[model samples]
Target: MRSPRRQPVAGAATRTGPPVPPAWMRWLPVCYVAVVLILEPLTPVDWPVSFLLVALPLVTAFAHGPLVVAGATALAVVLEGVLAGTPCCAGRSVGYLWDRHYVADYVCTVLVGGLGTILAAHRIHRERTLADVRFVADIAQRVLLRPLPRRIGNLRLESFYLSATAEARIGGDLYEAVPTAFGVRLLIGDVRGKGLLAVETAAAVLGAFREAAHEEPDLAALARRMEQSVSRRAAHIGGSETGERFVTAVFAEIPADGRVVRVVNCGHPPPLLVRPDEVRELDSGRSGPPLNLGMLLTEAHHIDSYPFRPGEQLLLYTDGVTETRDANGVFYPLARRLRSWGPLEPRTLLDRLHHDLLDYSGDRLQDDTAALAACLLDGGPRSVDDSSEP
Candidate 1:
């Protein structure tokens, strides 16, 4: 079933340009000038305290734009003249304003100010370019990994995705759920490598799953189709990396009856079954080769079925979730976290998991992560006809 597209979490971290400086930072040039003015009258004239104003434009450039830096430069030159001409306790004369030493100070201030203005302009241009690049990346990510529907048939779904790169919106991890005539078919996988190539591989896998989920009745056959798709994509890419490009994925089918869930594991992390009493891993005794490497396996892929009655939640995630490490290098305890929590709605379960994972890893991830949480609601479809209800 199709649902409205929504961000994974309400307050999830977003990729943005460099942070804006604090308000206090913006006033630093003014503060510096005030300090200079206060010290000029009290200090000895030999100190040439007015010459220190040359730094005004440079300081302003850090927090302000080109125009502000130029203004600060002009202000510094005028203030230097004022201080040179005004009689202080040292009894300086107005003739000192045109003194070669004072003139040199003014020239130096203007030179530094010109450089500061150019620096500010370059910084602003780079920020705008970075912003444009991030925008395009975000759009591509949304298109490749469209948000999963909150409700598909009798299942309540919630999903989360995080890229390891702070400025990247998507990476190697991917997940997709489609409600088909047979049931709700879910796919979650991680590409073998990082960067744009991995993203492209993920896109190929997801495109294949979305198209084949409705057509393939058997989980094994669906997996085979994915393998073929990945193989063709690799062939098209055609490089030394082609041999390294493979995906570990899990395919799940939640039947209309909502009595059981069938899962096919392909060299991927097993899904966790979270029940009110206990949590279980739906591990297929025999593991299948990952996509693009299916030819290495002579035996058929293993499909395991486990009871998935109402109130039970199934959590599907890439290895990135479990492999996340703490400051001490300990892997995240995914099952323990699930077992400790009381029954939670699908969205709440995933939201908590997302925050917990980030907190456990010190708010940094070594790999791209993706997760899908599905809770079977009460009075779910009991048959094919019952599944037709909206």
Candidate 2:
């Protein structure tokens, strides 16, 4: 049921920087100068079209740096002097160059140009600071929520994560998949809150899952380990929010044969299982408490198994996906959308979902969003040995 890994398409949601400005924006100041030059000759002498050149430095500052703006300022001053000294339209004389009004105009242009230069410098500083912040955030994302492999053993995987904050690359959402001797174990969860504290809690849960997924043999034991890890982490981060801090998670296991998938739902949204005929939510019959709250409950965590045959896809997501609201406050119809679409590759399916979600929410998500898609391909080892490596 497992298949070999395939190469992913290029330019697949890998951007982690600020958007680039349009090429045309850089020429705006030059175009303005050209227009001013052309109108100067056609207008009457009293019109003084060269006065418009005072705005040149401000226009350049919109896209250029301080150095370029300074150059633009100098250019505007020189052009103004040239227009004043030249005898162009009727009733205009060269004496206009030394006119008191022209003298005042020169001082005004220089003052505005200085302001533009300062503006450009400040803009550049802010941009560099933003770039540095994004770089640090990207590194944190790699360490916390690393990108998932395109293919792992028999499972073809694709993942998507979107932080509600434009400058942040990661947030409270976290996920990881490890192919161990037991099978391909998957973990996806969301911390209770936002900010640095939430990020620290997410890191603790992911660190525990990465380690426990390899060592633990039983799926229930893995869940227990995660719960203990979160509890310990909460203790270490003791504060008023310690009791409020928790994580909703789903742990999944797909064997080498890929015939069935076992899942443990811990106060998280149920994953969707998409088949050629229909789509359904893989809801566990009994729900378990979220991580860090196991001590309060005596009931044991339950593992539910579902038929995960080849050609079927499994989608795990956070509440942000289902809870996204449109202009009318209508929630995104995730299940309905999946049912309407035809059979699609795992990557394509997620790509479509990402765009649809953004469109539904008008590109304004209220919380962090994360999704992981796995497709069981046909043709692989039916039974993997206990010592087998993925």
Candidate 3:
């Protein structure tokens, strides 16, 4: 059996943490130096041997810091001097100290080297500033959507989130897990829009869920509480935009000692039930309208229950996963693709989906994607109130 506390989720794309090549790779410029040296003797007098010297610093800048570039510049200047004294087309060495050709060549080499060094330093400063900004964004993301624990009681948990906007660490997609008095309550959702407004709505929804999940006894009641919270918050929004905001969500509860999972869908995509023998979608007949739009529907939200036996897995995801399209506009067939895997642990399942989604989209997605996978362990669920007793 897999370890309960170990997380196997693939990490999100990180912009601020660009990979640095190995130390040995930095010496690649040494090969270019060799090429330039050999080419100098073979070229004709009009070929401009000093032109190659200026390239040394430029090439070095990519892998080395300003200090290293300065060292390279010095070596380049030395090589230029050597070239001036070497034999040219007429078998006579090119003039040295006083010749205008050598003087101009040396000056150009110095100028190019200095400019390259400055550029390298500026690049380093810009990267450092970006890193600081990303650190702040990471903190904000954690506060807004708290990270899910790898293990909660007897269930193994794994989650993945990818924002459509490049360089944006967080987006409107959200998920949260709360060990409440009733059971381990979970919420996965997607806001109707994107950008700052959507993020604010998402934050409001999560805050409401965290507070109410502990008080509600059933998944339907919990979903209604969340709907009320969103409605109340949206009511405060000014102008015609107030009624336009809404959220698609799926709320679930895994009881403390039962092998069953209760779900209340709110105009959201259905969750998948993957077992060793088969894969199926948990299509709840009692599903209702999305949050903030419940006034249109007269019936109370339906609560659907399904067996969640040991070694089985449940996957909750936003529409981003199902609606992703390729160049030909073909939607990602998640259920069809999932059937091929038979059964897998929560983390491994998410990891495979993450890569597969990227491959399908050619590494670019039209919307943000978020997924949560939970695997039932071979034991009775621990009481949420008294975990120490378990």
Candidate 4:
């Protein structure tokens, strides 16, 4: 029979608590079961004293629902108390060790050890369910954060991502792409911090962009919507200044049939212009601050337009990319390094850059790194109006 899926424990997680486990953390349960079996022989005393295996089932029990926990607890009770031999009761005569009370021992085991196991396993089951929910959240993000296309404008996109943490979860760093009336609008931004709060902000920004791209004809309006979304979120949190959350971002909209692109630099790193033969930063031509910083700095975001020629691609990213430190503690120079590697497809570029970035950091990051590359297609060749031709 199929094992019923478990559910997360309600009313357990506080806004501040232990971080959830990653999706790849399945082996932890198997490890838990193994530990239980190893120490089940002397539970509550030797088991708890030796290895705290009792806590394992308790935590596990908390994770699964009542039915599942009941099954596991019953099985463990039978195995440990009945089959494995319970301790002799009350020094009842040396001969009584294997006496007729065996049936009573079985019942006692079911009543006592079963209850204990049920409690422990329930906790564990709750934890596992919570972890599973968080994993699904991370996976669902990939849908809105689609992989960048192979080509844009005339440039070949090559991008890479590496989180500073061991668990490969996306947080703080964010990116997006959507077709608009003008052309394709893209964004790459970073929340002020890491973990769930940052992920939530990232989600809000992308969700707004996905809807705004199709509705807003002007890039300026699109930027405003995103800015409002962040502000609204901060307000919803209803915390003091120290409790406030914010993000820095860069928004860009490329024209369908031209070299002109509009960008709003909301306190983010400037994008780099990379070509087969040249590399330079796209002077954002603004003094505007980041999105959430607007409330603090009191500056209106300015829309800056720049030239995006064919054969040249723009690279946008979170600070994690350029700020990565080496053994000597020197930061990575993405502009110089990216130009050194010849043009590659979006996937290849992301993979290559991700690999090289990890190599620089020994495949581990202390923060999340997000990079996006958008290249203009057709270079300088006369391009047909493919939008309407089809």
Candidate 5:
């Protein structure tokens, strides 16, 4: 459902690791200076105390601009000069001015500090460029996975999409919910492959489903339309490799006036029906093959009908969820997990599943995941608040 504008939380779990050091770390150079002040007086000046002076400016360069680094370098130079003239060693300002070792240490600090400042400037520029590119990619992803309204007719809806790759914003998984004359139609599917090829196929399927969901009254017919669309896309892609371009999908029809839910399964995982009393899988007696394989099948696709009582919720997801493996290589038990939740509201149901899936997989999904939860509201289809609970 459409939440307020914000950064996407999906796939964020994968970024979990060491926390970034705090921004206040920029003051570390000052702390280093204080430590040097205490240590230089205690230790003999002949212990090469001036060597420690280079560290303050270099550390400052990591978290600050060149100006700050320059200031730190100047401070280090002053402190070195002062330390060289201390009673611990020479005990005369002329000792630092004429001593070759003292002069050499000061020269090294200035050269290294200047180099660190230049490197820091370059790093900041590169980071800004990378951020701009990533921002554009994120926008493209949001456009691809447009936010679904929380309410469509009397149906409460919530949806999430997670791309498997860390560098990607969108992938092969796809889901769409459309309100039509027949009812609220839903489609959640996974393309056979990843990257641009899969995304192209997903786009074609969604375009076909949107157009046919309103025109085709029968759920099977709508699926056939999607099959044709995928076939055409495969033909256009035109390679021996494109022959493997089929999509596993579950197409659903929730009639506005009926207590029945009709589904057409195309080699996809069965959806979970979460009722107050029990959670059941809406299995087709014998499912048809995935989209783009109608020509290979001897039998026609069949639509399966099941009761969808009011206050009940239906959960549909791509194989990524069920097939997600833990570090120990155990598949996530989606049906069993749903049974534990009883009858949760749409948004909360998806949130729990999203978090649970990431936790189970150690936040590393091997395939793209997409999930949608729809609750059949009483009093037929009508718009409601963004989070209309069941």
Candidate 6:
């Protein structure tokens, strides 16, 4: 089935069409060599300068692509013959335009440039192959772990995820959402480490939650499954000390009724609950340990719930959002910063947050960060395609 179209998230932008071959392709350095080799002996009218004509096609090929390269070479040959002279062919011997030197120079230009065009085409193919690989990897990542829904049921969802390094894609930060029997369950968390491994832990938590959310009636059981999944996976890698390897997270469910919400905070930042009347931070009340913290064996066993009303929204995220620091080494004022934008679509909220972060750091982010916001409403999602990426 075909997927619905989506709008580009605020900050993400991509260039269209093929990559440039190379600027020098418009004229080969070898064309420069041809001029020196042929110019000195030309019958002033012969103008070995015809050879220089080859450079335009060759350079254009490099600056553009194979088709451009071929046409450029052909145009160069015609221009060289007209401006300079043509070969002294027997058929046109009576004309000065048919001089032997002019013919030889024009012929040589085509031969040299034709070879350059062939080679430039190969280079273009190689570049396209590399680009294809990168594109496939990007598409696969988006599929395996689809982005958090822009709108889950009646709530408007918006998010931002940035890796620790500019080159990175996935990171230790993770979030997930799915419509379940109870409601639209959403989660946001941060692993202890960074990079691919953190993503693995995140996947494990999400996988468990997906299955448990629908099966378990009690919220604590759902939280336990997440804890168990992370713990079990960590043991397979790290062993006994894994308890200290925790994931700070906030989990919540937006019910079908659209009038209420419940949450379980596990050593994560308390989500800020925003309503038309007022904006307030929601505490964990009685908290559970973060998912991977194996404290479950001997520690407590329950998760907390909350009151989520319509026209209200919830913002859940890792410490990266609040912990961002600025020029004087001062931390970013998240609450005050968010106050700058009163209420907005989730995608816009995330876009502005990402922009604020980049601006705060002067065009670069220092640490990995992730944020997810959802607005409660009395209606179903506006439209599926509009809610996600295009």
What's the C-alpha lDDT at position 215 in model 3? 86
For 1-390, candidate 5 gives per-residue lDDT tens digits of 322222233322222222233567877887888887777656654575556987777888777777888888888888888777655453432455447887887898899888978976776776667667666666656556667777877788888886665556778888888888788899999899777887778878887887898899888889888888898889998988766889999999988778788999999999988899898888856888999888777877898899998899989999999999999999999989888877788888887887788778877778878899988887754532223322
TM-score of model number 5:
0.86
Per-residue alpha-carbon lDDT of model 1 for 23-103, expressed as tens digits?
999889989999988888778768877889999999999888899999999999999988888775366654478889999
Task: For model 4, give the 10-residue run with minimal summed lDDT.
Answer: 3-12
Global CA lDDT computed for model 4: 0.62
Compare candidates 2 and 3 on TM-score and give the better one.
2
For model 3, the superposed segments whose C-alpha errors exceed 4 Å read: 1-25, 88-90, 237-239, 385-390
TM-score of each: 0.90, 0.90, 0.87, 0.61, 0.86, 0.67
**RMSD over all Cα atoms, model 2:** 5.6
Taking all chains together, the TM-score of candidate 2 against the true structure is 0.90
Candidate 5 clashing pairs, residues 3+ apart or interchain: 153-381, 153-382, 154-381, 154-382
TM-score quality measure for candidate 3: 0.87
Compare candidates 1 and 4 on lDDT and give the better one: 1
In order, the Cα lDDT scores of the candidates are 0.83, 0.83, 0.81, 0.62, 0.79, 0.67
Clashes of 5: 4
Q: Tell me how candidate 6 scores on lDDT.
A: 0.67
Q: lDDT tens string, model 2, 135-159? A: 7776788788777777777678888
lDDT per residue as tens, model 6, 147-255? 6666655667776676655445566777777777677778888888766677777777767777887887766677777877787888887865666667887778776
Task: List clashing residue pairs in candidate 2.
Answer: 1-380
Q: Which stretches of candidate 1 lie over 4 Å from their true place?
A: 1-19, 89-95, 382-390
What would you estimate as the lDDT of candidate 1?
0.83
